[model samples]
Target: MACTQVLLLICLWLSVSDAFTYLRVHNKSEVTVQDHWFTQRLDHFNGADNRVWEQRYFMNDSFAQSDGPVFLMIGGEGAANPGWMTQGTWITYAEKMGALCLLLEHRFYGKSHPTKDMCVANLRYLSSQQALADLAHFQTVMTEKLGLGNRKWVVFGGSYPGCLAAWYRIKYPHLAHAAVASSAPVKAVLNFSEYMDVVQASLSRNHSDCPRMVKLASDTLIELLDYKENYIKITKDLYLCEFLVIRSEMDISFLLDTIAEYIADVVQYNNDNREFEGVKGGNITIQVVCDIMSNESIGSPYDRYTNVIQTIMKSKGEKCIEASYQQFVKDMRDISWESSASAGGRQWMYQTCTEFGYFQSSDSISQPFSGFPLSYHVQQCSDIYGEDFNFPVVTAAIQQTNENYGGLNVQSSRIIFPNGLIDPWHILGINASLSSDLVALPMQDAAHCADMYPARPEEPPVLSSVRRRILELLTEWLQL
Candidate 1:
């Protein structure tokens, strides 16, 4: 959650894209989707750079009408799966409105690689500014190629792509007529300590004692870590792949951060049972975690904590928990696309280091978790990239992001910002409606990107109503 090491580990266990938090790809759909490609410039800002790459996009015009709107689902930090063209709430909206649906894979993600490899030099072109330009250029090309003259365009994205969706509307208002930014973190911060605070709140909201147990477990782990002799005991009890070795503070922080992420993963995607590329999401809720922590028969708080880790690991078919700092650095340093860590993890880490400092740390005393500090994340950026990407550089980048985008006070219209109250990322999103056209719909008892998924029979009534309202707004904006 803090760096590429934790992110890659989460990606492996959760089988979800780190670029878009919990953005699932459904395998089955009623509509037929086709993949297409267009020539996209490597550097949109540079006039001298005539270099180009084939950008991949998916299209489903099954329900398109001559004068209907275009529904553009922007792909985030993952591969653009064609499943999105046939499924999701956007597809349903497209069906009803007779809109042409499109899913543009983000450059440098999936198969849309802009360069040869993810080496440090090639990654310079992989920024939000470049991505936004890619969107704008794609819009122009699509409008001309498809003869969609003056037709209204609606953009939809969740998580990081959601942030892009909102920013797209702000930056290129004329291009995108309306936008649906779900669980979008518009505000960028260096120390995202509030993420864990929200996680704590989500846990405590389910059961007050859950946070207490979690804190007790963290204290116990810290105590064990303080004594060098307890390394083997800690490693064996936690089912770690290797014996604990505390060469530096980061080594200890890596283990603790990873443990905290097990809880964060559940909290972030709690009860959002959206299917991902044929895999159904687990129904693991805060209560599920709380039930484990509060069971007295499960031994001490430390035992319950280890149980939580083991349960998640076993569910994901992981043999042992990876807590080695050297392994983390090794995986992160390998910039090859063939590497396991190259699955948008390194790219996202670069973005976090250079653009959005979404460094989730346990520095705050308000949160139940501890051990992972802001320095741990900052050190990761420097470790993976170079000394140039230090704390001061990261801080400056975050400040510039806020200054450029206007943070939560983003000036945009005819865009709907939907956030889940229980989601940790909601802290950076717009929770209040800015105006008549700029609407914010905050869903209670919802997790990250809940509204983006297709409607299910067991879904909350409020989620249903929220989807309906989104359609209603789009109808008004497009004047259909």
Candidate 2:
């Protein structure tokens, strides 16, 4: 505690800090490599226009073993900050295992903003290929920059980014020593039918407690789809107001998505007597299937049709409120309810239906309830018409068939793909082509992002086991 001793300690700390300054990347787009490390603007590759990149590095820091295997921690989606992967007990444990962690933000989603306009006009720029390229470039730069030319690095991600982790290793076998893909959907792409079908089944299985509400919403949606007027009328009634305009181009597919998602969440939560919180929990339900569905900006199927009607009237300067069910039936069309029987098609059923082991499409009419991702665009369509629509943007992107995504034939080093048995997205695993390179872990009673359970106390033992394995694998990988 003496001033003289404290001053000496401060001097020692400053010297150590200087020694620890391994590398730094500059805005001038250059790669500066030194004896123990290197830094560079990852976007400057091949002198080609940089696709909005980030810096990556490995260090033999004060705590890390200089001669040990170097580990790269790749977080999922919008993890622009190094502190992003703060959750998951296993993730924390992995970092403590002496690995030099590296995090990269997926383009357009976080700090790695897309160079192009992110509006609907330029949404196509944020495809998976661009992300894959960013990862590959980061790997090459980090390896070469810090004199880690011969060091081993690992890849790790959860949810959407987890898909990137799997595809990354398959695309560039030489870049990573191993990969840990948590709850990753590597084959779903344009086929969400399997996922939707699962959600529907989940809703149906819980019908005992909220049977009347569930049936009413589902029936209302089906009936509204019979005709455009009826659909608009129903939407207006549900919305309790009138707006001007309508889109004949708008398929009943949107309605179907609302109905299915509403019944699944609300009905199931009611059956379990578990409380469902709104935006506070970062969730909003679209419908009230027994008050179970989260608050969706668009309301439920019954309310959805009503909102449409209200909008149409409002736009036309008419104050029409009530829409007769009989009048609705008179305007019905003869379009057969789209089926998910087809394997690979552009139908909603094909796009959202469970592939159950094949990359088929779901041409069903229903949509997802979550608004942040696809659900956000689907609901917005009821009020506005723009390129921001999720359906249209994805409709174009999916048509491209990202062949390079799953093109490699090499075996993956170490990877784990977990899914929920009852979770809708789990169906993508069915279509997943599992080989020695991939390991599929499915939880029997969980839902999307369920791996965050067990560690969160709301999950089961199997979930905990998966978390434990991830830590074990990460520790082993880092020490290797």
Candidate 3:
């Protein structure tokens, strides 16, 4: 978690964009979401009249009355799924209140591209402020269209979008009655190394040796990178598909990411009740990792690590073991932007490069591996995005974010910040109250966006209390 702040790019592949993972196991049934679009402005702050684009959204009116609350789920870096309206605690809350459910896609993400292309010139409209405006406008249009303009509304989102939900209530207080921000990292900082610290703590919770062997295997990989003689065995030991072509350090870092993916995935999804109620060990969970670590017959700690890596890679169906480390290292002196994956990773990277600055650099030696240099990520702002993404520009943007949104110390009312105690990104969340109205719940035995997902069988008592509190708050706020 140290820098893989892609919580804008969840997994590290070029195509992967779950940067901050929000599970959307959407089961399509009868097309509940009536997909629609709003004519949104390209630049809410600067665009003139007629400078418009379509923003994607979905609405479900099953539980709606002529006069009822609207439950809005704010989509983040990934595509908006219809399941959000059907699944999750919010839908249940919506059901109880007979509220209409709506899902608004983030502008640069899903099918809500506001510009012709994701070029630097076009992506200027992809700021958080603009996205918030999109929500405000969407609400204005939809509520009015359905003759529900005067009715109360409640917004919801988890992870990065969670930050948006919190900030939305803070900024656009008149648009919605309350918001539920699950694991929202409101604070945008340059160095977010605290992620791995939580990872360390989570592993340590299971058994002392879990994080220890992870570190040992990391060190072994680092030591293996230096010796030319060990190259062949390195491939064989890690079960490489081909001879090591890239720098061993990059390969080592990528492999470390591969390893981190396993540990992080388990901790990220450690809400066992959601997947397995009382079972001690569930698939791809912390217990499973610990079970792997406990296997003494797996030979040395390195071999145990190898077995885990093999399992992870095979699950991903990876044929080769090379890192795409060279893409960001290109000379920015002669760089041109491309409209590739900008709707997803490239757009998230732009947001990260500009405001969040949560680069997942493997700089800390005490951690597993140096994933990427900060400059490599910072430069990629211009390398792939635009020239305005340099360090100076991004630094100013971060300050603006903190000043405008109150990063980590949000002063909003009627918003609930719920963080799973085990989530690596929890370190960035508000685990306490800023005021009587701005409350936070550090949900125990949870990970990532645990509170955002639908409740499961025998849900943890803390989660039950959280759900009850949110429902109560939203109900009370709307009635007032």
Top of the candidates by TM-score:
1
The digit string of per-residue lDDT tens for model 1 on 98-187 reads 898888999888878777677788888898889999999999977876778989999999999999999999999889999999999999
Deviation (Å) of 83 in candidate 2: 6.2
Name model 2 segments beyond 4 Å from true: 1-83, 119-125, 143-151, 188-191, 205-215, 222-279, 282-402, 407-410, 430-437, 452-454, 475-480
The stretch of ten residues in a row with the least summed lDDT in candidate 3 is 1-10
> In candidate 1, how many clashes are counted?
0
Q: TM-score, each model?
A: 0.92, 0.58, 0.84
Error of 3 at 186 (Å): 0.2
Q: After superposition, how far is residue 436 of candidate 1 from its true place, in Å?
A: 0.6
lDDT on C-alpha atoms for all candidate structures? 0.85, 0.44, 0.71
In order of listing, the candidates' clash counts read 0, 67, 11
Instruction: Give one digit per residue, the lDDT tens place, for model 3 in 62-141.
Output: 66766778889999997887767566788778778878788889987877766555555555667888889888988886
lDDT of 1 at 14: 16
State which candidate, 1 or 2, has the greater TM-score: 1
TM-score of 1: 0.92
Local distance difference test, candidate 2: 0.44
Model 2 Cα lDDT, one tens digit per residue, 1-480 = 111100001111123344335443322112222222122223333467332323332233322445545545454433233333333443344345644545565544433333322222333334555567677776785555455657676776655666677777777777776776655665535444455455556554544333334445556656555666674555545442343133432334333443344334432222111122111211222123323422246567456434433333443355543223222222221111121211112112222221212222234444222212344324333223233434555544444433445422325656667665655555544324366435566766655555632254544456677667666665565465
Clashing pairs in 1: none
The deviation in Å at residue 36 for candidate 1 is: 2.4
Name the better of 1 and 3 by TM-score.
1
Q: Best by lDDT, which number?
A: 1
